[model samples]
Target: MRLKVLTCLVAVAALYAPQASAGSKIRVETRTYDVTGASGIELIQNINRKGPKRGFMAHAIALTAYSASWDLVMLRRNGSCRVRQANGTMDLVFTFPRVVSPMSPALKRRWSRFMAGTHAHEATHGRLARDMMRAAERSAVGLETTDDPSCSKARREAGRRIEAVSAQYEAKQKAFDVTEHRGGGHVEHLVLALIKP
Candidate 1:
């Protein structure tokens, strides 16, 4: 029920600490949304309607959006250019429905379990995003180009390396989704619990 949106942002022009001494750093940003309804079932239905759509499925109990960007600083010395700093950042926005107030003990218990399961799944996706960002940063680090006229060649190579890393991680994310969301998987179990309770 919790789905994640991934965005790969363009290079940003910002001064970051030198990578030679400081190494790479990753920044994570997060946001949350709340939806409310009269009861738990209503809450679920409302959230499903309001959540983001993926492919043909328009209903989701929760959703997470992850946007990542990187800044690469190049240093030129002695007719050679090298990546001096690689800084990566990611933003994770999680949207979920609020548990209805004044619920019966049984309903409250089920709601609690549902929230826990959904959050856990979304957190895993967030972790994967962060990991991919870090990998991209590492790939961008230390890239060099000896082309004399301009560093465009080096820049292009660095971009390709970073993109390759990102693509590989993206494939991993898809594979994980397929495994985790297969029939009778973790997500299905969570949904069944919420509805059958």
Candidate 2:
């Protein structure tokens, strides 16, 4: 009886050991948007899905920069992928609920911009999240050594690069907003401006 109980306990411990070890890993959630109508729910869903990619990517890079900070990753992507209504106004606009995090003030600012960048920026977050998750998984599986200083440095560098790209995206967003409000009526230019640097 003692031997059987000990074996059962060992098996249970083995089953849970990996789970306990991986508790610190980040979680990521991604949503894709395709709105077929102008329904309010559909519009909100579309915007929410599209608005967070760049910000999320920026957030990831920030985490990599510090080599700390673990939290779930959320990415929203897809742009104002609709055409002008017959009434000649924006067919749709996107809005995502603000996220509150314990990140530093600087990180918070970057995250806000990233969240506010063009819808396409969300796609960047999706890509970055995948890459980060893969790296984390590899480390967890023992394929990569987390303790390597080189690994830490590489992550920091990658974070910085992503931030630079995000900044450009932000600037373009600002420019587009300006041109849009001026009644320039340049649809193609506005779309291009949103996604391009």
Candidate 3:
């Protein structure tokens, strides 16, 4: 069985522009891990200790991940094989930090701002992921080729298109991050404000 898989590892990432097909479904899930911090500095440290790990050494304040898998059916006609249909599903997971400790009024205000900004940032990633899945479905449905009768090449081409969409989306995500995380950028301002004592 040829299963088309697109996976992403990001600090909440990617996007594409394509109309969604009827055969595709996307499932979204959200989870939070609680951290103990009564102050902004403490909260940052708590997040560092409890937040989602992006790589081997750093933890992200929030993160989103997506994976797409699809089953493609191909039909052999006269002298060629073509994709009959592609039924696909995209699964997304979002992880964020939750503070469990009691906070003073000032701390609560700061935390509220931090959480709001973080949610806004992560939401962009979620939107992009959904778009990427739709684009992949568009690339796979009704794909046809005459070069290979066994339909392997057509399947490979579909996979290629799917990966290309993913790569494009990934680049978009990176560009978005660069803008948000640059010095004096939105994320930097948010982080500095949150951590200000």
lDDT for model 1 = 0.66
Worst 10 residues of 1 by lDDT: 9-18
> Tens digit of lDDT per residue, candidate 1, span 44-158?
7766766656558675666666666666677766567777766666666666666534677777788789889988877777777778777877888777778532556666777
Which candidate gets the maximum lDDT versus the true structure?
Answer: 3
Which residue ranges in model 3 land beyond 4 Å of their true spot? Answer: 1-22
Among these predictions, the greatest TM-score belongs to 3
**Residue 6, model 1: Cα distance from true site in angstroms:** 6.8
Clashing residue pairs in candidate 2 are 49-77, 50-77, 53-122, 54-121, 55-114
Per-residue lDDT of candidate 3, residues 123-159 (tens digit): 8887887777778778877787895666777778877
* lDDT of residue 83 for candidate 1: 77
Instruction: Report clash pairs, candidate 1.
Output: none
lDDT per model vs. reference: 0.66, 0.30, 0.74
TM-score head-to-head 1 vs 2, winner: 1
TM-score of each: 0.80, 0.24, 0.85
Candidate 2 has an lDDT of: 0.30
Candidate 1, superposed: residue stretches over 4 Å from native? 1-41, 55-57
Q: Of the candidates numbered 1 and 2, which has the greater lDDT value?
A: 1
Cα error, residue 27 of model 1, in Å, equals: 5.4
